[model samples]
Target: MSQTDVAQANPATRDAEVLIVGGGLSGALLAAQLLRLPGRRRILVVESRSELGRGEAYSTVELGHTLNGNAARMSVDPDNPDDLTHWLTQHIAAGGWPESDRQHLPVSQLFAPRGLFGVYVQQRLAEAREQGRARGSSVTHVQGEAVDLEIDRDGARLSLADGRQLRGAVAVLATGMFPAARTPQTRSSGLNAAALDPWDVAAMAALDPQARVLIIGSGLTMVDAVVSLEQAGHRGPIEVFSRHGLLPHVRRQPPAWEDFLAADLSIRRPRQLLRALRQQCHAAQAQGIDWQAPLDTVRVHIGRLWSQATDVQRRQFVRHVRPWWESHHHRSPPLSAELVARLHGQGRLRIHAGSYQGLEPSEDGGLAIRLRYRGSQESVRLAGDALINSSGIEYDWRRVARPFPRQLLARGLVTPGPLALGISAAADGAVYDARGQASARLFALGPPLRGMWWESTAVTDVALQAKALAARLAALPL
Candidate 1:
């Protein structure tokens, strides 16, 4: 048999210089950067979704699910900061936007719809693939879920759900955010199939117009639920419940403030850092500047701060300060903020601070929810037509029911990270095995790196990580 015969014999085994699982923003951007580097190689990106860049977050068909950040700040290219803005301008021009309407569109600062942003990402990836092909490199996008990874000394074998095996020099796990996991209380509760996914616009709209909705989280996801409901013309009252009852602050483009915390090494502990941050915020407020200025400065050094934290400090931060930090740091888009405010003012939305006890069947063919009020020991009961689990991404790996991750844990290909936030991996993206040793053939990026970088989910952060990972992979002996 000749080489061609052998190739035909092993039809299931596809070869690639690099194999990336989960072709969301992280994998797609990494493929783009790697193809642009000074070498030509074959890159394979496997995604379950039909679209390359749009995972669950951006693939929504609802136009009302807009991006949380502005186009100027959400570019996929770190080197070209205004790439998305420029792309949007060209896109609008190509779409034949009237000249009078062009000025009204703020490509730089406006929050584009999430679906449109997904298109922008897909377009960029397509361009990158074209560039790679022009330079003797190649990119292949396969629509499938990667179920398992088999590792050896030379490389790793990826098993897809459709019984396909891909052999590559290295494998990268870019599995994006997981769906919200119900708490133990929710599991034991009799309300089965009662919790609706916040992103299910059709199902949410199918509810009765006067049905009361109980949202189980007050973070950005809850905000998204609100936007979807309003778009579907839902006139029912919306109730948001969370332990802290803190809502995301509205996004703003503030002037760059001095990064005072970058040089403050003494603030190593979470308590010390929080105190210092408060002082900075107060000083900025006293000077008639928004507290966001000081918080923006902290973003510059957040990675370093998170990396330097001790295990105890990290745990303490999660237990005591995570809620406040998330609400303040990850803000809602301007349009979303305005809509939520108007709804609240109109008495259509209400937020409560409490703990969800359980759910019981209501007399009116709905669900009755029990909650322990924030300030009182007495429980409160609320009746609603529907409940939604908008509690955001469940970070704890032990709790997630995803099959691939569970398999990885059972085989000891990866270990849980600190605080069980995500998979354990080095800062350089080399994944650790059951024995806590880094593997050369296996790597990870994006949300799975939350343990290493607390703020790894943002596009900007993922872009930076992709660039660095591409550079490091380029230097590796392939």
Candidate 2:
């Protein structure tokens, strides 16, 4: 099809060489890199949210919502590992901030506020746009939700909720995590007041300060909710319910001479790697350093270890060990952890280790949570003024409620991975269809590609993927 014909076919399409969905970190970074390429191809970015950089992760209004990971290790630029630190220094210097306030620390030591990081990302995008404008290259940013994706003989087409469409030679899906799937019983009961997703800030805000709140899971999301509640001046008692009543560990300061996992450790099998990691952790602890040091080393080598694992080993890891791994690997900010501890110490927070049977409406117009404790023949019921599901994103691809994945599955444009955690994609993030044919013009990134690359969700891993994908896209002929 001709360029004019393509542009005329869709309202938002203007014959761009590349189109990116989801203007979060990955999409925004990709757009910036594409602008650096020596080409005149138009680039279009569609974001469902009004904000370009915040997405779901950094869009919180609470100032207490800090990044779990440190800033030194969270740079958008892969070439310079210290780019985020450099940016922080430059920003502080330009603003005449005190040097005492800004210290050179380990990337894992700095828990910057999530909104500040969002601002940094937005600044980078603004610079890219300015550069593109100066070079006379077309760049467009559209604010809309992409509800449908159609891949025809000519190119890719995206249909928005507003009845507008965008066509491009290539499209990248970086839509990030979908909302958590609600329990069947909860949905059937028709109670919309319960917050099934942590992103429902309005629902969380609507609760009275004196009302009791029950959080579904005890992970990072739960920490975020607790921190947000405290920041909002909530004075009510809070309860966190999970299988083990396990909360995320607090981030620790790194030791000066900590070295556990060697740089040359071979990780070809999942079990072997786990054993080695445990051994390294033990050794580090024995040396008077925290086990987190060794775990950090392992994180840097996770992609290689995951790539080496057999399908059975991968499934085993997910089934038997993924939860434990996540609790340790994804730690909470020290401040958040301290707050949780303080709440517990003061009898304001209660953590229960039990299986959530279901929820029932109480006579008092609250929620009666029925749960079964371990080794108990009898079930118990607890009442809460509000319920918040902080269970994290529902990972089962079959249960996803979004239109793009469902439509893609119906059209045979995508298939679930062997373990079905996410869509099947090649090593380079090129998505494969149900027919087992890889699409040359389509790719998947971020959490959706978790099935293929087990370590793709974290900021460090996604940032590296963004840089590599940018170079790959730049090399592609328009």
Candidate 3:
């Protein structure tokens, strides 16, 4: 198609050549991908937040909240694994992130604050914007929440919360992960309504120094909640509850190991992969090496292994191996892990394996919760001064009470992803409608494709998907 045909001149009919529904990391990276490509089209990104790159994950201003991965592995550039490290090097040298001195590690191994990472993402996007401008392409940020979207033979029409509408040749849904602590649910236990936000240190600060705190879920989020409480000066007893009561293993820098998955293609089934991985870990331990060395090699093969697995195999993994996989894979940062270890040693933090039943009526102005301890049928009542819902991400769109997610499901624009993790989509990111048909106009990236790619939420996965989707959209007949 000609350059003129790529961009429509009518402001009413075509506000942009492409419309991105979310302006978080996923959306921002996708925009960068499209901008760098040779094109002459207008792109508009709609986000509710004032800032563009920081979504729920990176929007936190707390110095204690940091990315789980180090700078080397968290690059937004798929072609360059060291991109974040390079940026962080100059960032530290320029007197930014003064805390870097405490780690005593090279910039490549440093764990960066989420706020600083957001700045890096924004700067990269700005550079891409300049590149796009030189190629007669432009990107505009529309500050508003996208509530509804409709696809047509020509393109897509998007509606914002403030009653504004925009038309584009294609629309992309990059709405990031919805943390259970904050996102509304259709049917909830009312825990979120009464609980303090997991990332909200200010709310935690209001509590008495010795107030007892109850926490639900013991994943990386729970680790963050502990860090938040500590930073807020809360020295009270903390009770953490979950079905498994498993804590994330602390992250460590390990040496490179063999890419076992690449060398052995027959290890496709979950059991087979697990057995092989176990053998590798045993071998590494025998050699006085960290087990994480071998585990990191499997990161590149997850999408292929997940997508190609049978439904039965996938179920087996989720039911039997999922909790262990999560605890081992999604590791806690060292600094936060140190605090948790110290507190646990001091008897200030306790972990219980139980299932939360519901809330109870409390007369002492404290939060009361009922729980059935593991292996017991009878429920028990537990009370605390505060509660936090660190239950993790709600990937099922039907359950999410957000207007946009609800609208998309109600309108049949998208379907629940594999195993109901995120919305379903083809390997190339063309979203599948409720009818299981791949869409040409609608696309999704990041956490929305969790069901499609089991490890889709990581920065590397999103970066690769953004680049591939941008190329697919660029080739369209729009």
Candidate 4:
């Protein structure tokens, strides 16, 4: 008589055309695309949060945590490249944006607070839902966490946290990024001293303004933390350390350049691609153009090139090239970059190339952090009132303590991605078992597909994948 009993008794009666887990950008965009299909279809989106489309990255309400790019570059729809720009213009016209916030910048190039973008995504999803209704389709949003997945002959059944079960003809894992799993070094230390969330405004505000602060990563997340400290009127010295300590480059408008890599599908290897990219960077610099223009050329071809790479070559890139590639490709916004530079100039911020060794309780009831410098193994000690982990999300699902991923691995529903970077799946997002056989009713998108597509994080890439997956799932017999 319960939902679980009903789901097990009559799977088809409980089934939807597609069941999308996570309800984040990947799921929402896929739903949007599914609604555009010619035939009637049902999409059921399951989310842990009450709202849909915000995901973890855009879920922050803090003003200091802003998107890394301008409004024009963040649209969920690739066909409408300037959709966000147009939306912002309309939003500004309707007095949606604050007047004080509007005066200093161009709307097209503005790096608005991430919460505003979340609202935009929600609005877009609502519109798509209505559009689906007009086209004899339906999208239902369910609130709960899917703790386990069971594949049956009929389809797949998802067990929710509240003891409810839902069935769908097919399922897509749009689970995005998971929080970093605590390493052995981080685990032994007192969490109060070192393991603070990077996005907690209250925690950052509680820090003593004059006390030293230590941050564990030198990327965009660290930029957000610095901005939060400054906004809270903290005048303390800050230390940022990472494996390479390579900070993201500041974003800038660049002149268009020829897509030199576009025509060259022959450069399939990572080393060859790196060499070609370096040549392009040098040529662009010689022409007084930013090297990013050349780098962007490789973005579209990444999935193809990555698929062609051998496992050993993929491992080589992960070990040797990933850090520099991330720093070069994932640049920070102009405003945040300027703030970081200003802090460094004032001698209030210092960046070190090193790896965290351990954390110890200091004499002053603070954290004594140990690190090994990049080139040498000598340990260095530093003390701070608090340490925040800004090292970003952990992509390897095996390490995370989440229940659903563990269930999938145990049931042989999914495998670790190529090089153990993300959830392993086929190039088109079909879920694969440990034996490397693809599933007919299970799929994935977004960050979980990073193993197949190296450049899977950006909105542009997610949008393309969502569109493709939607079309593929839509055409399948229900």
lDDT of 3 by residue, 131-152 (tens): 9999999999999999999876
Instruction: Please provide, for model 1 over 1-478, each residue's C-alpha lDDT reduced to its tens digit, 9 standing for 90 to 100.
Output: 1223222323234498789998888888899889888778788899988778888778887767788888888899998989988987887778722331422546787677888888888888888888888888888888887888887655778888899888887788888777573332323354326787787778877888878999888999998988888877789899999999999999887777778776677777778888988998899889888898888878757778898999988988999899999999999987788888899999999999998888865787778889997998999888888888888886666666666787788889999988888899988899999998887778888888898889889999999999999988777656
lDDT of 2 at 31: 82
The model with the greater lDDT, 1 or 2, is 1
Instruction: State the lDDT of candidate 4 residue by residue for 296-382, as single tens digits.
Output: 777778888888999999999989999998898888987779989999999999999999887865787777888898999689887
Report the number of clashing residue pairs per model: 0, 1, 0, 0
Stretches of candidate 1 exceeding 4 Å from the true structure: 1-14, 96-105, 181-192
C-alpha root-mean-square deviation, candidate 3: 2.2
Q: How accurate locally, in lDDT, is each candidate? A: 0.82, 0.74, 0.91, 0.82
Which candidate should be chosen as best, given TM-score against the real structure? 3
Question: What is candidate 3's CA lDDT for residue 475?
Answer: 88
| Count of backbone collisions in candidate 1 | 0
Model 4 reaches what TM-score against the true structure? 0.93
Best candidate (score: lDDT): 3
Q: Can you give the lDDT of residue 92 in candidate 3?
A: 82
**Candidate 4 lDDT:** 0.82
